[model samples]
Target: MTPPAGYTKAKPGEVFRLKRSLYGLKQASRQWNKELYALLHSLKFKQSTQDYSLYTRTQDGEFLVVLVYVDDILVTGTSTSQIAAVKLALDEAFTIKDLGDLTYFLGIEVHRNDKGIFLSQRKYIKDILVDAGMEECFVAPAPLSTGLKLSPEVGDLLDSTPDVYRRLVGRLLYLGITRPDLSYSVQHLSQFMHSPRVPHLKAALHVLKYLKGTLDTGLWYSATSDLKVTAYSDADWSSCQFTNRSLSSYAVFIGSNLVSWKTKKQQSVSKSSAEAKYRSMSATTSELVWIQGLLADLQIPVSLPITLYCDNTSAEHLPENPMFHEKTKHLKRDMHYILEQVAAGFIQTAHVSTANQLADILTKSLNSSHHHVLFAKLGLISKVQLEGGI
Candidate 1:
């Protein structure tokens, strides 16, 4: 620790004393993390290099996974007796609360059954709707209306209570963690957070209405999943009216279960649609490589040459061959990382029709009918519908 500005002269052997632990202390979280890591290490758990909070261990064909958040611990494994033994050891070491199964964690509700696990933030969504006074609003088929174009400069300033719009948009962003269907809508509304406009607020209201209709919608992770890894890559060129930057989106799956998805604006502008698509492929490939390594750490074998599907053939060709149009040449020079992964047989590029692109949902808003089709294909479904409760 460094001394205060005026008290820089500290003897090498001098000791600093501390009082009782307090909430706002500078080292509170760090101290907690270090202590927990040391204790887990003593238990023979190896910390993950990718995520420090994650710990894993294996013994006699049984695997255990542990994740720490501050003082809370989430523990799971293949062997029931092993998990029980871990809990007993922790109870002996420290005063602990064992929240039996993970029915809910971090505001995301978990529903499990013979089918699989269903993740949703329904209570969180309802709170937002109530705050916006749209709890009774009419339902919409999709979060964003077709052909709805929003810009920072289009509409007049929100007359009163602009902060309401800002607050709602922020909450919606957090909700997207479990609701990928809301990704495009929330990302669009976030653009005008600095100075929201009337048009933007109206669009945000549309999203709330969509959520009302799809209150039970969420991601479904099946227990019968296979280890086959495949990913879909997509890009919407020049989708943003304010910045003209392309939107990149991809959905990665392990068999029929969706494991990862992303919706973000590209940092650099692309000259052609193929350029935008190829750049998106690079990002998706990076995520796929990371997932492969993590699975390997768990002793799970991923099949060789994971397949990547793209809607554009030109974008697909960039990875298959070295020579191409001006767009491909520029991308190759700047993004040789993705090209090398392909050249070494780490990934195999393939073409899929645009309608079959699961990533399309994250990149742009389609009409109500098209949106519903893609929504289900992305492994998102309403819990009520599955249970015959809707």
Candidate 2:
């Protein structure tokens, strides 16, 4: 604490102290983070390199993991005693109230049974529906219309304020955390946040209607899931009519449990479907590598040569084939990176038929039946359906 230039008071070593909580200050979060980091380090927990928010400590062959999100912290692992100790330490230090079990945290609901754990944002979705005045909306068969192609300039700019559309898209983006089925649709609607049109607004509302019908749908983690890492990568080549950008998507799994997935438009335009698909594979490989590191930090062993499934035969062969085609000269960097991983036995590429491509749901809009089929394969389940409810 530096003294004011004009002040000639007191001792040189005297420093000003903060009398109030740092709740509203910008530096509050940073200071809190630093303090928490120091405390966790003192507890012998190693912060994960893959994710700084994650910390892990091992004692007597048991693992204790801590996940931090601002003030909300989640403690879990193989050792219950260590978790309790850590909680007590945190409470004594910061006066935190322990929320028993992990049923709810940060707006996500967790359900556990003998089978496994189920994660959902059902109440969050309901809140969104009510905010959009769609609580009584007619339920659609799917989140997106079959074969629908959204164009930025197709319809008149929404007569209502564009904030409505922007807010809806933002909420839906957060909802996608547990709802992989909404990934592609939310990604599509997000593109027009700058200047959303009437058609775009309608499509966003359609998603709300679908949400009303499948309110209980969410990812299911099976207790018996293997530790094997498998990933499915796909691309909708040149899918955007206006930008001509291809959509790349991947679904990553730890055995049969879906852990991570993404649907994003490619930043650069690809000349061929193979190139687009290859780019998608590159993205998926990066995610797979990160997941492997994170699992290792958690003391979980993942087998090598993680299977990466792609629908394009050419893309699948690009990493293994020695000869590079003239047309693929532009993708040399991507090819080299993928090949490096393949050579080191970090990942193995396999050709999967489009019909069996689970990531197809993330790359493009599919017919109702096809969408549901792929959705089922993505490890999404509905609690209502399990209990024989419509």
Candidate 3:
């Protein structure tokens, strides 16, 4: 075929090649990123080393941030004109669509108010519940059953289809974006993805039943809160039935708003409760450092010594003391990275009572009272209003 005007020709008997950019071609993303980087450099925007997707430019003592995810861009600055100028510059170079005031993007529902921006996946949750045939099912009070120790011998499997089990788990994983309460239970059932027994599938459906009752639950960001970073860490010793491995969990907050959290089974067995708590604390500290870098790129300066609260006083004391007991020596070298940060004045460890530890919900199943307390602490609420604007 003959090549069109202003088009580049390929080898003999080949058609004209499509223009290389971020969205269309195989190597388009790399090429478009290179172009965007060059443009930002020309505009005096400095790229962050910690996260390359973040870019910043300062003028007249005011800061402007531009976060790029491929071709999608988010700009926030001290002034609207500054953001407008950057958008105009980008539009001149490439065909751009301005998504004014991000409401929905990348499966996350963004709600902004005078208080702050809140991000959730409520619509996604509703869709998953409807798809799983649980839209009309009775709503359970919790994501997991009380005293339910799901093991290899729970019951005879009813769902013989392995693909159905995988599909259910895949959808549940997406729900984890807003439902951190489901993290441990989801992680527990996900292990049996390959050749999932009938019991495993039943346990997963129980989680779906719980979601049916709490589909509207989500995290809320408060605009009135300060940007102080604090974290809580906890562990459930020997929680896994198959391996007897302990479960470690952590939840981080910027003031009263929860920002990040995790619930995962530890790979190695801990000798004591103190060892388990220490391991969980170490994992939480690593996440804290990464978040600090992210805030720095956004020009949000954090004061020295981020605070981390742990319920285990023994583990807290061990970090400051050089006397490593025989039992504590088994921890890997990488786990000590957090200790180094603490010594360098990057993080400060504190003590919290076990009852007040928000990460407890992530580590183990709790009773209704404790569950409600932790859920409220995590910024979740049940706001039921009458139809007549009651």
Give the candidate number with the greatest lDDT.
2
Sorted on lDDT, best first, the list reads: 2, 1, 3
Question: TM-score per candidate, in order?
Answer: 0.91, 0.93, 0.87
Give the 10-residue window scoring lowest on summed lDDT in candidate 1. 326-335
Model 3, poorest ten-residue lDDT window? 381-390
Q: What is the C-alpha RMSD of each candidate to the true structure, in Å?
A: 4.6, 3.7, 3.7
Q: How accurate is candidate 1 locally (lDDT)?
A: 0.86
Report the error of model 1 at residue 366, Å.
0.7
Please write out the lDDT profile of model 2 over residues 1-390, one tens digit for every residue: 788788788478899778744789988888989999999999999999999999999888888899999999999989888888999999899999987989999889998887788889999999999999999989999988888988878899976789999999999999999999999999999999999999999999999999998999888888888889999999999999988999999999998999999999999999999999999999999999999999999888989999999989889888998577689888988998999999999999988999999999998878899999998888889987544522
Per-residue CA lDDT of candidate 3, range 113-149, in tens? 6656666677887788777787888877787777667
Model 3 segments more than 4 A misplaced: 1-26, 152-160, 332-336, 382-390
Clash pairs, model 1 backbone: none
Please provide the root mean square deviation of candidate 2 (C-alpha atoms, Å). Answer: 3.7
Q: Could you give candidate 1's per-residue lDDT for residues 265-327 as a string of tens digits?
A: 999888889889988999999899889878876778999788999999988877767665654
Sum up the clashes in candidate 3. 3
Using TM-score as the yardstick, the better of models 1 and 2 is: 2
lDDT of each: 0.86, 0.91, 0.81
